[model samples]
Target: MTTNTILFDLDGTLLEMQTEPFVKSYLVEVGRHIGDKYDTEKLLKLIWDATKAMIVNQDADKTNEQVFIEYFTANSEWEREEVWPLFDSFYRDVFPTLSHLTYPSPWAKKIVETAKAQGYRVAVATNPVFPREAIFHRLAWIGMSADDFELVTVYEESHFTKPNPGYFAEICQKLGVQPTECIMIGNHMQEDMVASTLGMKTYLVTNWMEDRGEPQYPVDQRGSLEELYQALTERTGVFAQA
Candidate 1:
């Protein structure tokens, strides 16, 4: 099937960064900021538990953010109004500091532009475990913005997370396209490429590769951002003008 929509994973694929270190830094900074009121270890554990709940969530009534918030506050002594603002503040202030761990890819802007110019709808299919504020900040680090994509999945807007074929299906539903009409470009083997299970074409980006195990999905293409740019240009005959 011909591809009309392209879903790009944000962290390691479009924005250059090592996922492990970035995540560690994020957890540490968040823990330190909220340490005075909450036990650092316990708080971190709660965050993970809440995140896992969001991942496996199959509920259509509640969004991933709602699921996380309910799970997080219900299991803790804190109230949502009190704790959520603090988390938002950390994302606004402390999260930007983590940008030093990431750099903008030279081909990032070109790739998105080329896809759009070639008549493909673009969306950021980053894991929806993060709030919109955090996702927006990360996009800024790469010199992009939420305005760059047709749709951007955030915790508040998504019901499922990556590695779940349902997540891709939900996105396709939102985009009003068939799964076969969408192409997923991401770095992780398990998380991103699993979109293939739903018939969406997959591209395994190797710039900051995350290998989980032997490949279980078919990748229609694989390469660095620069290589992807060239491939897209050749295939779509859409190039950025000087």
Candidate 2:
């Protein structure tokens, strides 16, 4: 299929970062900000566990936010009334400070802009484990706005996370495109490349690849972000059809 749509992963794909350290800082900082009456360690653990719950969630009706908040408040001393403000304030205030841990790719903005200029549809298909506010914050680091892409997936509006075919399917349905008519571009071997199961073409970004020592993944193409930028601009290799 000649794909007209492209899916870009945010974390290590577009916004460069060491995933483990960034996640640690993200959870620890949130704990520090909201652990006034709660145990800091326990609060971090609660967030970590609830995050996993959100990632594996498959409820079509309940958003990931519903699953995360329900699981988080149920296991902790916090009530719904107490949950909203603490987390909301943390995202608004503390989350943006963590941008220092990430290095934005100059090619990321260029690639999306080039794709738009060429009339190819684009979407930020990052794993919706974070709220839209946090996702937008990261997009800002990459010099992108939500208006730049046809769809931007976020926890509040998404039902599934990456590596689950449902997540890719949900995006396809929303964009009114077939899975075969889209390209999944990301750095994670299993999580991002899993979009291939839904018949989407896959591009593995190896510069900051996160394979977790798993068996080799068979993707349609593999390269760095700069190579991807060139592919979009010159219309070569896997992007030749575009």
Candidate 3:
């Protein structure tokens, strides 16, 4: 089937960064933002727990934000009205400073432009564990924005998270396309390549490839973002506009 849509993962794929250090930096900054109001360890634990709840959430009625907030507020002493704004402030004011830990791929823009030029829809299928503001800020690090994609998944907007076939299905449904008509591009074999289980073509971008032995699904292609740019340009027969 002709591919009509391309889904790209944000972290480690187009935006280069070591996951562990980046996450630690993020948590530390958030801890600094919270200060003595909450214990850093306890707060981080709650965040992780809420994130896990969002990932496994099967409730189609509730968005991921609702799921996360419901779980987070319930487990913590803070009420939603008082604590939610603090989290938003952290993303808006503090998250941008972490850009030093991530470098953009030279071919990132070209890849998206190529897909658009070839009449394919583009979506950023980043794991929806972050608020839209945080996701947008990360995109800005690469000189891209939410407007660049047909769909950008965020916790507030998504009901399912990555590595879950339902997440891909939700995107396909939103795009009015079949799973086979889409391609998933990312650095993780288990997370991105798992889209193949639903018939989506999978490309493993090895820029920061995770060392997951023996992928559960077939990888249609594998390469660095630059090579991906070249391959996609060739496949789409669409050169970057001068």
> Using lDDT as the measure, which candidate wins?
2
Model 2 steric clash pairs: none
TM-score, every prediction: 0.94, 0.95, 0.94
Candidates in descending TM-score order: 2, 1, 3
Q: Candidate 3 — which residues are off by over 4 angstroms?
A: 236-242
Task: Supply the global lDDT for candidate 2.
Answer: 0.88
Output the better candidate (2/3) by TM-score. Answer: 2
Q: Tens-digit lDDT track for model 1 on 30-112? A: 98889788788987899999999998988888899899989998898777887888888898888888888887876888999
Model 2 worst lDDT window (10 residues): 212-221
- For every candidate structure, what is the RMSD over all alpha carbons to the true structure, in angstroms? 3.0, 1.4, 3.0
**lDDT values of the candidates?**
0.87, 0.88, 0.86
**Candidates ranked, most accurate by lDDT first:** 2, 1, 3
Best-fitting candidate, scored by TM-score:
2
Summarize candidate 3's per-residue lDDT along 155-202 as a digit string, tens digits. 888889878898999999888999988889999888889999999888
Our model 3 lands, by Cα RMSD against the true structure, at 3.0
Error of 3 at 217 (Å): 1.7
